[model samples]
Target: MKVLFLQPPMGGWVTWGKHIAINVNHAQLAANLREWYPNIDVHVLDCRALEIDENTMIKILKDIDPNLVYMGDALQTTGVAAIHPRYKRAADLIKSNLPNTKICVGGFFYGANAQNILEETESFDFIIAGETEATMPELAKELSKGDPNISVVKGLTYRDNGSVKMTDYRPLIKNLDELPLPAYDLFPMDKYVGFNYVKKYVETYHSRGCPNGCLFCVGWSNYDKRGKNDWTKYRIRSGKRVVDELEILVKKYGAKFVCIMDEDFNVYRPRVEEFIDEMNKRNLNVPFFFMGRAPYHLRDKDLLKPLREIGFVCGLIGLEAVDEETLKKLHKNVQVDQVAEVVNLFRENNIMSVTTWMVGYPDDDESKIKNRFERIDAIDPDMMALQIMTPLPGIPMYDELKPFIQEWNLEKWDFQHAVINTKHLSREDLGRLAAWANREFYSKPGRIQRILYDKNYHPLCKLIARCYVETADKHAQAAMKNEVFV
Candidate 1:
């Protein structure tokens, strides 16, 4: 049987960056399917990398004429997380164009509501939930057998008569080392670009599931289903295994920098330290970045400094809300004082930091919101992102704010839109505040001066710093006319 894995066209936000990257997980899924059914012809169409449009996609599907279609909605070449709406459109078009083809959907969106997704997109015949490495192979074997009882398939959801049938969720993968390295070669490697902050980068996941139960985050709730393991529960691959993949990218694919895309890069302190040790011992000079919590950084200040010296450029710090009360509401374990200390630690080590802040949280009042903004101005990082609080489905924030949720469109959930009506701030007010934060933080000349004065500034640091100022100026000018806030 022939199978085609389709990654739909991503929105402009993902395309805005110079280099468009492929979803590592999608490549892994393709590789897993090939490993399972070696006889089955497998083809991958990454729309973002190839820059394929509706007509191009239609022609490709028609030409392949596969028996089954596996569409990935997790991460498009676009940087955004949620499945693009175009996936549904592509599935619908394929179903109409090729009646013999069976369509299936998987990835984060489907994981959230597998049954509804399959039903809503009438084109899809089945839905696979969680860790496609194992599930996809099992699903294929069952389908190949012409099994009519798909409901019996574990981690599957499908339509039965008028109702949706969902099987039990699969357990998380324990031995990540057992899995094959992601099929990066299957993608157009040259098309992928690192963000402005780094010269060249490849994204790799160290583990699945995060223990941090930050309310505004969907990742937190995602792991909550796995019983007592804290929402931040993490299972990491061996350092040798991680380094093995990096070596392949470096030796064959020419990856100079790696962006460790874990929810928190330092989840297991010993493992992280070991990983850093392995990289150093092997003389792996590849620079890397990661997502880290302020508290973690503070605790591991000594350990992190060495990593920085060994090409760890910068990372994203989740300073969700500047005010303590707002942070408490968001379930972010760190305090405001901790944020200041973390920033100082990064500065002391000469590592650049990109801090993320959320405004207009559900429990926030005008005073609290103002205080948050003031804190943002006071504790400004080298780079910052200010977004309105969005209550995504399956998260505690969503449950708490569902009554006040004014919109449900997936596209609008992109931090730019105010989907929920806050008690203290109106939608318009939130938009303005976001615009104000962008202008205030980026508009100041002193922001650049601080980076320049820092003792540990590298040559590449100057290049990234210039890019930040230019991007900020562009945003400020654009937002001034109330044209670019959304």
Candidate 2:
């Protein structure tokens, strides 16, 4: 049996210029398939990182001629997550070019719309509806036999006699540690580059599933069938295992920085503490970043300083909004003051923090928009990512906003682009305001000086700060000229 995993090409996130993070999903799945089914030939084609053209992808498919092609959705919750809708076209092209090869897809987007994908695309023979590690191998083994019974395979959707049918739901993995380390050696690791924040940034998945039930998030929706809060059930690898992989990445792969791509890194303090202690003991110091909620940072205040000692110099902090009312509407459960406190903490500890702001709420008007940015300016985060609010499917707000969504084209769902206008703002106006907010936050000469000259910030962080301003200025200019997005 032969299988090829692909990370399809992406229309780059509009907020930043062309850059590709490592497709950790592809690497991890390839590792699992290789480790469990040793006799089966496995390969990966990372079109996103390599920027492989369609011609090259088709040629590689023809050359390898694998029996099955697999891809992942990167666990997106919104239309924005459905990157490069070209995947449908690519799959169609592959089927026409190679009639016998089958395609399978699984991830956040696919899992959410399994029946639709299976029904819509002739190229997609199967959709792995849950975590693919355990389920994929079982399905592959069944496929090896003639006329496999897919009904036995849990968390799958497939065509049955010209109709889409789904199998029983699969349970989320109880222990994430059971999964193998991603096969980074198989990837073009050298080609991977981080965002402006870190150049040679390697992504790590120490945990899976978020514990927080943010109403706008699709985290809970993915596992909705499994029962409520199933999706929010947090699972993580041992800290030793996490740092052990980091040591390998640093020593073998020349990783300058590591991105802990957990939904919530600090959900459990003990795991974080263990990882920190392991890093200290091994002296496996390399710049690292992770995403954390505001409250957790407050809870783990003491340990954060030592984390800095281990090269934990930066991370994304979710200051999703400036006002308490907006935070409540989003079900962020984070206080506006807590948001301010955490931003201050990161600053005090020399940790460059990236925060987010979403415009276009129901109550959003010119005055509200102005006040939001004013509060943000007062808070003064190291970086602020501004986006027009997009209510993705499965979120509570999706049903409410669906009728008002002006851009039904899924590809434009990228957060940077406004898909829906608020009751108070037009889509174009939302885009303009978002642009204005970016300019407002980063345009000051004093702010620019602090960003570049802050002795507390790492040199790479300084570079990121400068790059952010330039990008925002470019977007602001485009927005001012009435462009929906830069």
How would you encode candidate 1's per-residue C-alpha lDDT over 138-172 as one tens digit per residue?
67656676545576667777767867777777776
- Compare the candidates by TM-score and give the number of the best one: 2
Evaluated at residue 40, the lDDT of candidate 1 is 69
Regions of candidate 2 where Cα sits further than 4 Å from its true position: 75-80, 196-198, 218-226, 473-486
Q: How many collisions between residues are there in candidate 1?
A: 7
Global Cα lDDT for candidate 1: 0.67
lDDT of 2 by residue, 268-377 (tens): 88988999999989988898888898899999999779988898888777766777776787778788777788888998889998887777676678788988889878
Give residue 476's lDDT in candidate 1 (0 to 100): 36
Q: Estimate each model's TM-score.
A: 0.89, 0.93
The whole-model lDDT of each prediction reads 0.67, 0.75
